[model samples]
Target chain A: MALAIKELLAVLKDKKGRIVLIMPPILQLFLFGYAASFDLNDIPVAVYNQDQGADSRELVARVIGSPHFHLYADIDHEQQISSLINNKNVLIVLHLGPNFSANLAKGPGTSAQVIIDGRNSNTALLVQGYLSTIVSDFNVDWAKRNGKPPPLASLKLRAWFNSNMVSRWFIVPGIVGLLTFIITTIVTSLSVAREREAGTFDQLLVTPMRPVEILIGKSFPGVLIGSLEGSFILLMAIYWFDIPLRGSLGALYIGMFLFILSAVGIGLMISSLAVTQQQGMLGAFLFMVPAVILSGFATPIANMPQVVQWLTYADPLRYFLIILRGVFLEGDNSSILMHYYWPMAVIAIVTLSLAAWLFRHRMN
Target chain B: MSPFAKRFMRLRGLIRKESLQILRDPSSIAIAFVMPVVLLLLFGYGVSLDAKDIRLALVVEQPDAQTSSLTSAFHHSTYFKSITFHTIQPAERALVTHVVDGIVWLRSDFSARLLNHGDAPIGVFVNGVDANQARITQGYIQGVWQTWLQAYARQQGHDLAIPVRLEPRIWFNAAVRSTDFLVPGLIALIMTLTGAMLTSMVVAREWERGTMEALMVTPIRIWEITVGKLLPYFILGMGGMLLSVAMALWLFNVPLRGSFLVLSLASALYMMVALGMGLLISTVARSQFVAGQIALVATFLPAFILSGFIFEISSMPAPVQVMTHLIPARYFVAILQTVFMAGDIWPVLLTNAAALLVMMVIFLGLARHKTRKRLD
Candidate 1:
C-alpha cells in the first residue's frame, strides 16, 4: 500500500499529470457556477401601452420594477414592437388593451393579454411568470381600491420537486452527466493521445495487456475520477447550495456508476480513432456537444420533434438525466430503477464492446 | 521582388501543407463534415418544448357536472395523455410523493357555479420546481379554459371581447426549428474547431517534432514562416465554412435570405480572426496539449455556449454579457443569423465585420510578436 502510494505521488509530481488531474474539474466548476444559468433575468422587454391610461402606465411600472426584467423600449406603434422582437432586440412585448383602466375599474373578471416571443421557450416562460405576478398584484390593488373583499378566486402554486427553483438543484445532478463527459472523454482521449505521442502505445501492444485490458485500464481511472467528482459536486450542492437529495443514495450511486461507464466508453472510442491528442480532443468535443444538448439538460426531450425524441432513446445521458431528476427530486426509486437500468446496462455493453473493437483495430 | 509577392508565395506553400495535413487525417475530416450534421439532426429531433405523456392526477372534490366537464378537458387534451383521476387527498399525496406532475382541484357546486357566473376559475396545482415544463402545461390548460369561456360567453348571449390579438409571424424560421437556430451556431463552432484547434496544434507539433528548428535554419524569414503557417488554415477554415453552409442548406434546410456575397465576405473576415486566434494560441503554447486545451476553453466553449448559439447572450448577466463581447463567435453568430434569416441588414453586418477585423488585427499582432525569432 505504501509503495503504491509512493508510486502514485511520484506520478502526480509530474507537472503534466498533476495539471491533467486538477485543471479539468476546477475549470468545469468555474463554468458550472458562472456560465450555466437557466434562470432568465434582464431579458430585453419592449412595451406598447396602447391604453396610455393609469392601468397601462401602472402595468409598465410593474414590469420595469421587477429585477428579472429590463425594459429596452416603450414604443407607440405595434409594428415597432414586432420589428424589435424580430430583430431579437426584445424577447417579450406587453400590449395593453385600450380599455385597460376601464376593465380594472369594472372588477375581478377582467383580463389582460401578454404577448411573448416563444423562440426561446425558457426565457418566455419566465417572462410569462413575471407577467402573471404583475397581473395578480394589479388584481389585488384593484380590489383594495374598490373596497370589496379580495376576490375569492386564488391560485395557490405548489411547486413540486424543487420548490425554490434554485438552478443548483437541476444543474448539480446534470453536472454528473457534464463531468462524466468532460473528464472521462477528455482524460481517456488525452491518455490515448499521450501514449501515441510518446510512441508508447505501439510498445504497449507487444506486452501482456490485451486491447480490452489496456482500454479498460486507461478508461477505468477516468470513470472512477468522474464519479468521485460527481459525488463531490453533489455533496457541495446539498451542503452549500442547499439542494435536497430526496431519493435513495444507493439508487443514485448505481445510476451514476452506469453513467460513468458509458461516458468512459465514449471517450475511449474517440481516443482509439484519433491519431493525435488534438484529434482526440476535437473528436471528443464533437461527441460531447451533441450528447450534452440531446441529454435533455437544456431542453426537454418530449418537446423535440418526433424523430428527435426517438433519437434520444439511444442517448445514455437521457436515461441518466431521468434517473437523476427522479432520484434526487422525487425520491422515486422503483420506476427509474426498473425502466432506466436496462437502458444504461445496454449502453454500457454496446459502447464498451465498440471501444474495445476500435482500440484493437487502431493498435493493429 | 516586391514584399507582397514574396509573402504571397510563402502563404501559398503554407496553404498547400495545411490542405495536405487535413486530407491525410480522415477522422478529423469526417468529424469536420459529419459532426455538425449529426448535431443538427439530434437537436432538431431530440430537443423540443411541447410536453407529452405528462403524468397527471385529477382531483374531483365533488361528483358533479362541472367536475366531470373539467376532468373531460384534461382527458381530451393531447398534452396530458396519462392521467389518474383520484380524490383530493390521494392526489395531494401523489404530488408530494412525486408520482404526478400536477393535481386539478374541482370544487363542490362546480356545475351550478359555472351556470351562474358564466365562467369559474379552476384551481390548478402545478409542481413549480420544473418551471419551464410547468409554464408550458399552464399555457395548455389556459387554452382549454379559454375555449370553455368562449362557449360559456356565447351561451350567455355575450360576444367575447377580443382585446389583443398577436399574429406572430416567426420570420427566418417559420417553423421556429431549434435545428435552424442551432445550425448557424454549429457553423461558428466548426470553424472555431478547425481554425483554432487544428491550426494551433499543427505549428506547436512542428516545434515539438524539431521540424520548426530545422526550418528556422533555412533562408525562410520569420514573417514568411508565420504567414505560411496561417495560409493553409485560412483555406481550411473556408472549406469548413462551405461544409457547414451546405449542411445548413441541404440537410437542415435553413433559408439563406441574405446575399451569398455578403455571407462569403463576412465568413472570410471571421475566418481570419479565427485563424489569427489559432496562431496566437500556438505561439503562446509550446506544446500540443496546452495549445488544444487553450483553444477548447477560449474558443470552443465560448462559441457553443456564450455566442448566443445555444443560449441568449442578451439575457445573460451584465458581466457575462460583457465577457461574451470578447468571444469572436458572438459577433460571427450575429452576422450569420442576420445574413441567413433576416436578409442583409447592412448596419449590423458592417458593425460585426468591423469587430472581426479588429480582433484579427490584435490576434495577428500578438502572434507576430510571440513568434518573432529571439537571440539568446
Candidate 2:
C-alpha cells in the first residue's frame, strides 16, 4: 500500500502529466464563468405607434422606461422592420393601431400588435416575457384611473428548483459536459502522441498486454482525470457559486462515469490516428467544437431544424446534459435516468469499441 | 539569378512540403472543409430566438361569444401550443406555480362592453422571471389580436385605415439566415485555432524533441529559417480559408460580393499574422505544452469572444471593449464582413490590411529574436 502511494505520488510529480491533468479544468472554469451568460440585456427594439394619440405616447414612454430594452427607432413603414429583424438590429416591433386609446377606454376586447424576430429564439422568448409584464402593469394603472375593480384578485409567481435563475445553476451542471470533453480528449491525445514521439509505442506492443489492455490503460487516466475535474467544478458550483444540488450525489456520479467513458473513448481514437501532438490537438478540437454545439449547450435541441435535431442523437453530450439538468434541477427519479441510460450505454460501447479497434489497427 | 529569387525558391519549396504534409493528413482535410459545414448547419438551426410550446391558462368571468373568441385565440396561436381554460381562482394558482407562462382574464361584461364602447381591454397577467421572453410573447399576442380586429372591422362594412406600413429591406443578408453571418466568422475562428495552435507548437516541439539544436547548427540565415518554418503553415492556413469560403458560397449560398482577388490577398496577409503569432509564442516558450496553453489563451479565446465573432463588442463592458482592440481576429472579422457583405469597401479593407501587416512584422521580428542557437 505504501509502495502504491509512492508510485501515485511519482506520477503526480511529473510536471507535464500534472499540468495535463490540472490545466484544462482550471481553464474551463474560468472560461465558463466569464463567457457563459444567460442574462439578456441591451436588447434592440423598434416602436411603430400609429395611434398618434395620448394613449400611444404614454405607452411608448412606459416601454422606454424599462432598462432591459433599448428602443432603436420609430419606424414609419412596415418593410423597415423586416430589414431590422433580418440584420439582428431590432428584436421586437410594436405596432399601436389607430384609436388604440379609444379601444382601451371602451375596454374588454381592445387589442394592439407586436411583431418579434424569432431567429434567436431564446432572446425572443425572454423579450416576450418582459413585454407582458409591462403591459400588465399598464393594465393595473388603467384600472385604477377608471375606478374599476382590480383585474382578478392577485398574481403569484413561484420559480421551481433554480428559483433565482442564477447563471451558475445552469452553467455548473453544463461544466460537467464541457470539462468531460476537454480533459478526456486532451489527456488521451497527448498520451498517445507522447508514446509515438518517444518511440516507446513499439516496445509496448512487444509486451504480452493485448491492444485492448493497453487501450484501457491509456484511456483510464483520461477518464479518471476528467471525473476528478468534473467533481472539482461541481464542488465550486455548490460552494463558490452557491448553486444548490437538489439531486442525489450517487445519481450524478453514475451519469458522470458514463459521460467520461464515452469522451475518453473518442479521445483515444483520435490519439491512435494522430501521428503528432499538433494533429492530436487539432483532431480533438475539430471533434470537441461540433460535439459541444450539437449538445444543446448554448441552444435548445427542440428548436433546431428537424434534420439537425435528428443528428443530435449521435452526440453523447446531448444525453448527458439532459440527465444533468433533469437530476440537478428537477431532482427527477429513475424515470429520467431510464430515458437517458440506454443512449449513454450505447455511446460508451460504440466509442470504446471503435477506440479498441483503432488502437490495434494503428499499431499494425 | 538574383539572391532574392534564390531565397524565394527555397521558401516556395518549404511551402510545397508543408501543403503536402497537411493534405496527407485526412483529419486536417476534413477539419478544413467538413467542420465549417457542420458548424453552419448546427448554428443555423439550433440557435434561435423564437419561443414555442408555451403553456397558457385562460380565465373568463363571463361565458359569452366575445370572451370565448379571445380564449380560443390564445389556444390556437402557434406561439403557444398547449393551453387550458380554467376558473379565475385556479388560473391565478397556475400562474404563481409557473405551471403556465401567462393568464388571460375576460371580464363579466366583455361582449356588452365591446358592443357599447367599440372596444374593450382584456387583462393578461404574465410571470416576469424571464422578462425578455415575456415581452416577446406579449408582442406576439398583441400582433395576432390586432390582425383579428382588422379582419373584424372589414366584415363590419367599415374600411380600416392602414395606420402604418413598414417597408424593410435587409441590405446584406436578405433572408437573415444566421448561417450566412456565422460561416465567415467560423472561418476566422478555425484559422486562429489551426494557425496559432499548430505553428506555436511546431518550433516548441522541435526544441522539446532536441531537433532545433541540430537545425540551428546549419548555416541558414535567421530570416530564411523563420520564413521556411512559417511557409508550410501559411499554405495550410490558406487551404483552410479557401475551404471555408467555398463552403460559404456553394453550400450556404452566401454571395461573394467582393472580388475574390482581394479576399485571397487579405486572407493570405491575415495568415501571416496568425502564423507569426504562433511562431513567436513557440519560440519564447520553447515547450510545446506551455506554447499550446499560451496560444489558446492569447489567440483562440480572444478570437472567439472578443473579436465580435460571437458577441458584439459594443455591448461589452467598457474595459472589455478597450481590451478587444488587441485581438487580431477583430481586424480579420471586419475584413471578412466588409468583403462578403459590403462589396470590399476600400478604406476599411486598407486600414484592416495595414493593421494586420504591422502585427505580422512585429510578431515575425519577435520570433526571429527568440529562435536562439543555444540548447539551454
lDDT of 1 by residue, B1-376 (tens): 8987877776677667767877887655765566656765665556555467676787666767555655676788777854555467778787766577787776665566666643345677777656567766665665555565555556568754433222333345545455666666667877887788778877778777878778778667777787777776677678768877887888778778889999999888888888888888877776777777777777877787788776667657678889888999999998887787778877778888899999999998888787774412
In every candidate, how many clashes are there?
A: 8, 47
Model 2 earns a TM-score of 0.76
In model 1 chain A, the worst 10-residue window by lDDT is A1-10
Write down the worst ten-residue block by lDDT for model 1 chain B.
Answer: B162-171
The local distance difference test score of each candidate is 0.70, 0.68
- Model 2 Cα lDDT, one tens digit per residue, B136-215: 45566665565565555565576443322222233455455556566677678878866887788767877788877776
Recovered share of real interface contacts in candidate 2: 0.12
As a TM-score, model 1 comes out at: 0.85
TM-score for chain B in model 1: 0.85
Chain B TM-score of predicted candidate 2 relative to the true chain B: 0.79
